[model samples]
Target: MGKSQLMEKHPTGKVQVRAALLPLVLGAALALSGCIADPQPGPTDGGNAAVSTSAPATGELPTTSAPLETTNASNKAPVYWVGRSNDDFFLYREFRDVPDQENPVTSALRAMMSEEPLDPDFFTPWQNPKELATSISGKNVITVDVSADAFNSNLDADTADRAIQQLVFTATAAGASAGLIDSNQQLQVVVLVDGHTGYLGFDHIRLGAPMSRSTGMVAPVWIIDPQEGTELPEGVVKINGRSTSPGNKLRWRILRVEGNSDKTSYLSGEVTASADPSQSGIFALSVNLGPGKYELRVSRILSTQGDSEVNVDSRGFVVR
Candidate 1:
């Protein structure tokens, strides 16, 4: 347990949380832990499906698209798929069973193309025709070639922009996680339609440049540890997420949910986030609990005025 400080705002944007005692300020015993990043949202209302488009006559595997090396030792791999909500796009993780040897990028993209999300809140606007191929280069750039149907995403420009991000974020994250991209480096991707260029989406984003993860395009906070649904062997769990913190601070809470009611079980004692505000700060805390089932939420107040939560991520899990 350690003494923590609360940062109080004074109408101006700048505020600092300190270790000094302040009356009526939120405080408690706290322990720091490690962090990681990565959530879903509800479905869109009246969202349009991608319009069908005729496949180009030239849609074929390219000469440079050689057969990918298969690493058949693992039966399953982690993959990311993009799903749409009315306001934003979220990346959801799913484990896919693969042959002993398969290309990581191909495995992930096939899942993205062929499957619909199991969660109700998420939907993919792209109609997967299974005419997709993938290859990686030395610069860690992944090239995803799909049939002309890839360009048939009928979403509005804003939703289409998010749809593009959905593809970029899902492929990039899945690539790195599967070790196709170096873990220490960021992943970039290029989408190719029908073995050639000259294809554009509703967002009008050209396909020439490599794409990286833009955090603003997705949910701000994700529960990075203990995963989404797992049986905790111990009473204590390490919780972490990525987000821009207000006044250099982040907050977390654990609630025990019984039947239809929620009860507060633990409040993080003023744990601060990683100092980098430009990047989503890494916030972490270790909490001990005697629980059955709990809902964990991590949030931060980005505004100085009303103290409303700007970004929040939640997860539900059971503890034994």
Candidate 2:
């Protein structure tokens, strides 16, 4: 069958076609894979109906945002979403609170499929499956059984590849974060549709094989702390995040959100992320500001002459 005719067989083919054409029409501003940026405001709290305010006691899994302060918990688990940086589509992660009873891996996948990311710029194309489950073998292989309905979204080859990695990254992160798997060992994921193998994923990629994280799939830079829509007391607000390729230095800026969409630069500087070969690029800085909405942006310095930067990551916050 022809590409267009083949796509038409899927329920969401038209929507996927529009999404694929968006980047061509809007250029870098709307660059993305099958995932499209959300236009709405406010935190989604993952797929959870409500966010709880009470903190879970020590030694217990936190199900609410209350423990965020004392425990320094970002999100209950890491859920990867697709987004664009430097005009290229890549996977970005957001720590999110999943349901209390749900397994970390399952919850993360569920959230990735159904929930909206806190940042409006990030999104996912996976649909929520009616049934989902995960099991980890001693060999560090994670088996994911998801209902076939989760593959409802039609995607092109590139987006399909990214979508698969989204699952791999999220499952492994969840497993390691929850102590269900050894972080020191190599891990792989095998996806099964409706508990059966050999199911085609998004009508593009063949499934039921051992899959590992693909290099160059993740965003080169990502804001890790003071997540989008965070409200902080006036003081020295700490800004920290991860960078995959922190050459020599990274640039940062704080822009105050003035009127509706206007942003006035409040602070700008250069910072260095850790250069340790054994660890990913980690950087931190602190800035004090008065009560208002602000954005923290970071980027890799590509060149010293003129203005050349790439792989930007930013987050919006409120200084209370």
Candidate 3:
């Protein structure tokens, strides 16, 4: 068969090309499904402590602390951010100090427009959409009102699509994190220009409809735990993250990156990390290492495609 086309055109002259969803790669990325318990037994002294490499026989992750306590770094709400690698944009998360009672969806959007991303690789195509206003109407639809100046045309069609997606993803993420919406229900977002719902997105994609996240729009893997540049007093650290691949276990590796060189000392071999069978949940692993800068890479082969690193997440950190 000929190549299939997924395209949409705006009333003006812009085109939105919806990329086809890549087949789910088995055991791909971080399949976060369980709770992160306190750092398990590992060598804290100068001796290299062997990290726990075994997954408990029970598929159910160890339960500890209340759901509220599960929130990373206090009760700060989660705000999704957009990171670009090559020509693709992937979704990332960052916590904000905004109170849980406050409208975190709005707070997150404002932050997305105002602050620079903490991740150096991530960036936004936004220029601080002016006078941004957000609200929830009807049951679970989020509406964002902004001026035309927010629709800067400095980006190409693809980048602009990701930018708009960033807004939809962040809004829903904030809403869910703030307890304003339920996971069993659907949440959607619509953009309005100066009180009208027919505004154009950065790339001229029509913003009149309520947008929902689709499988093709997200990064295959993400490292949600031990935020980048985190300084840990202990050598043992718990790593957590989320993924889309369906499998019982994923692969992980820890490497001591040589300064200003291509060389790296492999601390952990091809270790397997247990994942929740539900696809996206907390996947935890305990690792012990001496004080130094290290890079952690979690990856999986594309079961759908040929053998290759289809989805991977790498984080760099320092131990003191």
Candidate 4:
């Protein structure tokens, strides 16, 4: 009788251990899901798109672009030198002068806003055209990775959310532009701690948007097809765009071919970042183009990754 009781107790202990581990396992999966989100905007010939010309005038309908983000160390006015009279005054710039809508790092900074439900139809959506994330911290099939420093340098969780809102408000003032974000994008905001993937508790700020006062979390996504220049059949080519990051769900278009100085043609498209960094998304096109001496253009909407000129990968094959 004693032996049987002992055996039963052993199994019970094992069950207890597993039960305790269940929440841990679930938590790990949930945390990883956040880091693996994807999406972003931009990839154009514009050299280093610093400020977007898309902001609306002071008070207008609503445009797509927003005003730039800035940081003010002080709240004093009439910053001036040793004025000869009181009239010799210095110029005082606002806390945030230009919008933080072009660089990946800055985009992440701006994304801090919108934690709560935002006006779905206003603003350019993502901050910049190009993303400034790492290689891959994928989810499902969509892959992406962004730097954590980008978020930390800008603002804390409490402030990040408001910053993003500022971007939306400024962008829509002159009348927000539509069609910047497509329907096929997803989003994710990963917040790294000290350089390693950390927990997503209120401990740190999220890489993307803001949430309600108590509710805190993120948006993630993953792309499953047309993997970065994946060649399709000859006659029927399926070309589309999506954010590998959890946050990037905007439209994807070929942003003119990269490194094609010889070919004087424009094969361009627009790409948006949803959850992930916009830089990771690859926007491409496919058509019933009969194989011949044709140039393969690798396009980017807002990126500085490849050579400035349009690039053409020479390929020849038959359709039939």
Candidate 5:
């Protein structure tokens, strides 16, 4: 399809001709899933954690070139950020409120490059680009055109790869969540720098080729609700998060912040994620507490033979 045809198909806005040439790649299947759960009051010591086992939905791309109307009135979109767990870095996500005028893909990329993550542990190496836009083809390929300034951050090869995958995951998640793309098919993302290809990313990975989500790029465990520095009511506090280790035991601890950097463990226990291998690891538990500053830490329970290194995610919040 040509630029004029893409514009005619998407009448909502004029298509920005940012790329001199668009590259196409074979599509591969990619599965993206998230867990949503309502917290139910349970024992604080060791309660039955709620798990979401909902099946993944497959979406069909609209036949017409017109832009797909999104029913997500909340204006919230998913944006992935890079964070460290143990010695390795991984991608973490946050659902941010975006402008309604922008499509999910654009909103997500802009946020990923410019916005700070809700969790202090998460950060983005991407500098805000002076120009950025995104378009999706019928083949489920998303093309992103961004300014070269976005790659200003200095990073090693491995970190650069994770940073690029951060964009891929965010764009795909945004499209899937908005029902703008066909989720049943494999999706790929191609990034362009200032209407051209072959731009080196972070002085490391070369751009222009189609990229998909890389394995082991996502954090093993992440706290989804009660984000960092959130304030909650002084009653039953519900904690929710996701884990990559499904059917595995997760150890959780609630620490009371005593000083500027000191945290004394208040409550600790273990909860098992859903045993169903098909479902994403969604775990939820609640604890009643009085008003105070606290932190929630969660990590997988490794066996004796496993490496001593642990991957953990923690969120600091206040109960008022």
Candidate 6:
């Protein structure tokens, strides 16, 4: 819906998407969305990009279609996972269930798509998605029967869009042109479910085509209680965060305590999520703040392509 706060070249860079940004873009209608930043340039390939970006390409849909059967393998489709770092290969999970019929994953994807159509790229469908196409001929309906594999994807929303675009691009290339942003049965995506509202639905529900690509400012990090500047409630203060983001990419760093609001420091230390999941999981620094006034400055590190402090939600808590 909106561009990342800070866009670098590598995607290799970082983008700070705050919670406040989502409501404005999502609005009332939930549809597929897309993101295009200022477009800084960086490496063409690398797993740890910093800019935090996404791109859509029209891929080739294989000819001679086959049956919509189920299989238990990582049946990833052939997509060009562009970018330098982690944006290389995509994962197409093959679920045992189908999407066109009753299923939980289908219901969630459909519900989110219809209600929040602007963000249809929220969830991924079954594996080998393009192969599960259906043509109504005279009718305008094209059921997107996804398999059980999609439901199993606990991937955050951002990461979800990457996979969705790949599937939509390929599906559109193939003859299933009946599906699109318009038309009632124009595009229907279905999947299996538990029968409830959550991911594991009670029964199942289906969706149409056109997954959304809304990547607004999401809550990338949660600075635990006691706040950042607060001193040791436990001599060994625990620094941890409950993390979830689309790109499977979201990292924060503690750039040493700023001597003053001027935002300058004589010395600084750096830590990345990729380096230590436990340490990077949360921006924690146990160093003493001394008895003088100081500011806790944190940096948003995308893979290899970003250059701005997306967020600085630090407070003045005491060590006493």
Which parts of model 2 have CA positions greater than 4 angstroms off?
1-75
lDDT of 2 by residue, 1-320 (tens): 11232123345343252134213211111110010111122222222111111111112121210001112234488888888775556777778888868777898899998887898877676877899999999999999999988878767777777789889988988887777887766788999998888998989888999998766676767788889899998656777666654234567777778769798766676665443432334456555566778898887777665557777888999977
Model 1, span 1-320: residue lDDT tens? 01111223335432222222212211211112233221122112222212111111111212110011123345455545443322334454545565535466676666665665433334455556548778888888889887866555444455556567667766665566566776445567888878776677644666757777554454444455655566685355666554433224445666667776656554333344443322233455555555467777666554474655544556677777
Q: What ordering of candidates by TM-score runs from best to worst? A: 2, 5, 3, 1, 6, 4
Per-residue lDDT value at 130 in model 4: 31
Per-residue lDDT of model 5, residues 1-320, tens digit only = 12232112125332222212211121222122332233334434353333332333333222211112234546689888877676566777778888867788999899898877777667776778899999999999999999988887656677677779889999888898888898767788999999988999888889999987765566777777887788998777787776665445667777878768787767676656553433344567666777778888878778774723267888889987
Candidate 6 vs. true structure, TM-score: 0.26
Please estimate how well model 4 matches the true structure, expressed as its whole-model Cα lDDT. 0.24
Per candidate, the number of residue pairs that clash is 2, 0, 6, 85, 2, 79
| Sliding window of 10 residues with minimal summed lDDT for model 6 | 78-87
Candidate 4 at residue 202, lDDT? 29
Predicted model with the maximum lDDT: 5
Query: Which candidate gets the maximum TM-score versus the true structure?
Result: 2
Off by over 4 Å in 3: 1-45, 53-75, 84-87, 98-102, 258-263, 270-281, 302-307
Candidate 4's residue-wise lDDT over 59-97, tens digit each? 111111111122323321111000010111111011122
Give the runs in model 5 whose Cα sits over 4 Å from its true position: 1-73, 259-261, 305-309
Q: Higher-TM-score candidate among 3 and 5?
A: 5
Q: Model 3 compared with the native: what TM-score?
A: 0.73
Q: Is 2 or 3 the stronger prediction by lDDT?
A: 2
Worst 10 residues of 1 by lDDT: 58-67
Candidate 2: pairs in clash: none
lDDT (tens digit, per residue) of candidate 3 on 48-150: 6555543422244422110111223355656556553223456667675663443667778877766666555455555566677788865788888877776
Error of 3 at 217 (Å): 1.8
Ranking by lDDT: 5, 2, 3, 1, 6, 4
Candidate 3 scores a C-alpha RMSD against the true structure in Å of 7.9
Select the stronger candidate by TM-score from 2 and 4.
Answer: 2
Ten contiguous residues minimizing lDDT sum, candidate 4: 17-26
